[model samples]
Target: MDFLERIKARKSCLKACETTVTTVSGHSYMEKILADGTSVISWPQASTSPGYVIDTKPDLQVAHVLPGLCMGSQDVAHDFGLLKNHSVTHILSLGVKPVTLDQMLNYTYVQLLDLPETNLISSLDQCFIFIDNARQSGGCVFVHCNAGISRSASVVIAYLMRKESMNYQQALMHLKNIRPVIKPNPGFVQQLKDYEKMIFTLDGK
Candidate 1:
């Protein structure tokens, strides 16, 4: 199915995220900081139909209400018309593959990492490598998936837990703040709890 269709079908499943996502190259960049001290950004693509040029400059930030889940365009993500000043190096894709739709044409950031689907165990694995790479690079990490809901949030949550040492609730709050639309599947959430419990058991917590 088309990317737009996928978003329309799952809009209700996403939660309310109040964080600001900047639209630079037509793509959306939802920014957040994880417990690991690694800078986390969610590239939800915002929407399909592109609209007005919001902001441009030394301090550019945007608050958007998304109608769907599919990504915007990479042209918009790399449009530098507004992002010329900032430097993007790390990219984290929660989706099995990047570029869901015919969006990200030629735009390329610096480094890209892909994680498996969202679940307690998979999330932990995804973050182990994701955070390590982010620390090694000292650059920002951009993460996205089909819809940026479950898969992206789960992995990012794990990163928050490990790096920032935030508890599950605390980490989840950060995710919601950034992408008010992020609602991990109930099963996904349970899995994370299980994973957390497992860690506590192993660590004698």
Candidate 2:
């Protein structure tokens, strides 16, 4: 099926599923429970579009993944004061756009969908370049998506695996240690596994 067809099918599936409001850590969000017992978290407001699942409460927490790398939700990305405080000189927006463009910070926007089937591997090379450029320039990069739970998390995990010479599990565990809330979709997890294999192959390891 084509992309649009797949999106239509997903929307139909979501519409047919049972959704409930659930609270965790004092934050409320919609959870769509599928027939297979898989639950997908969604935004508080009604929207089935990809990248729309944001926390109801403003998430200002930014986890410092590395010396010059940080991960956060769009809320923190949009907050000028928070970004300034973090000394963020570059912003990597995944699957979401900033409210306004800030001239002071370098921006790299990647068009990604918060879906299992979304192809993040193809975009990783460019993302790595953008991130490394900021770090090499004595600047920090803030990576974020709608909620910093899926797309952005996957990118950071892939970055760690490649840059730090770690395996998928090692990268994930290290990231989870710093940001426990990150949970990449199943497809992204598999892709990261595939990426690990590819990396080893290219290195002849």
Candidate 3:
């Protein structure tokens, strides 16, 4: 099926979310994060197609990590229309295989052979460089893997750690606060822990 058709079908089958997504003609909702670090979603009286969800149980889509960075599943990576709408300028793939989507024609693409059990510590620097360069250039980047949970999340966390000088726990908490579905594998988790020590020592932090 075409991308638009797939989106329509998915919307038709939408279920209840914590914010209670509705499709009533003219019904509206907005999501906001409060100053107390809590999020609340409320729907008012307005009308349009149901809003897109960043993360849904059993269903997957891209999630914004920062203003110029995002993480998502391979499905989101393939949806060229979505990427175009978001003005994504770069696509970083953490899967073993390269991205072969026709929709990626206009985007700079990078594929890294990052498996769940692979040694991510060695590759973290290269991944960070790619994402950092895009952000510095005022371009947006979307990183993805097969499931958008492990490999991609690891790369994002590593980037945050390097750029923000955050420890692993702090970075993980910040990511979960927004995406809420990132869970790196045990092996990756260990690597991230070791990485924290390595980077800290190098910088004398």
Candidate 4:
């Protein structure tokens, strides 16, 4: 199946699945049983309420997309030590719950879902302002989502395309060179292409 077909299949599968919330040792976990009898378990970060489980560790990996701009997973954003080490003073959180860290750091939270149908372009202007403000103030900005794969990667690519005057393909290629795991969903890719045209029109190029 092609990309759109795959997306449709996945969406149908998701719609057909049954989901349940269960608490284990105060941590809430979401369990989904697909139509095909495949079970999937996920830790719902927002279910933890005021804060998340600090003990649940994820691999500490961050990729520098630009001089002062970096991209990583939600875990890297929550890690105080990692933020300090990277000198990340601003955070652009996409589709993930905000973690309370320090008063010195700034955060811009966008309620984005990591679904292909989600409109990522509408959030780009706000995100770009946050990133630009951080860069102007000589502070580093770390952009992240759940897995640092789709949502966050698309944001970074959009930033590069807008600020650097690079096309979608060029920006995507540059980011892929730095972070090979970067892969924006098909819907996001189409939106980015639309954004490029919008930019060109505004620039009279």
TM-score per prediction, in order, is 0.49, 0.73, 0.64, 0.71
Model 3, range 64-167, lDDT digits (tens) per residue?
Answer: 88888988777777677787787788887775454556643334444544455778877777777788788888889888877877888888998888888999
The worst-scoring run of ten residues by lDDT in candidate 4 lies at 46-55
Model 1's alpha-carbon lDDT is 0.50
The count of backbone overlaps in candidate 2 is 0
Q: Rank the candidates by TM-score, best first.
A: 2, 4, 3, 1
Error of 1 at 144 (Å): 1.1
Candidate 2's displacement at residue 179, Å, is 0.8
Over the stretch 143-179, how does candidate 1's per-residue lDDT look in tens digits? 4544556665676676666656677888788767756
Question: In model 1, how many backbone clashes occur?
Answer: 19
After superposition, the stretches of candidate 3 with alpha carbons farther than 4 Å from their true spots are: 1-60, 96-116
Compared with the true structure, all predictions reach lDDT values of: 0.50, 0.88, 0.75, 0.87
For model 1, state the Cα shift of residue 188 in Å.
0.9
List candidate 2 segments past 4 Å from native.
1-55
Tell me the tens digit of each residue's lDDT in model 4 across 1-205.
8998887787666544555564554556678777664688887664544333464568479899888899988989989999999999999999897797998999989999878899998898899999999999999999999989899999999999999999999999999998888899989999999999999999999
Look at candidate 1 and tell me the lDDT of residue 62. Answer: 19
Which candidate number maximizes TM-score? 2
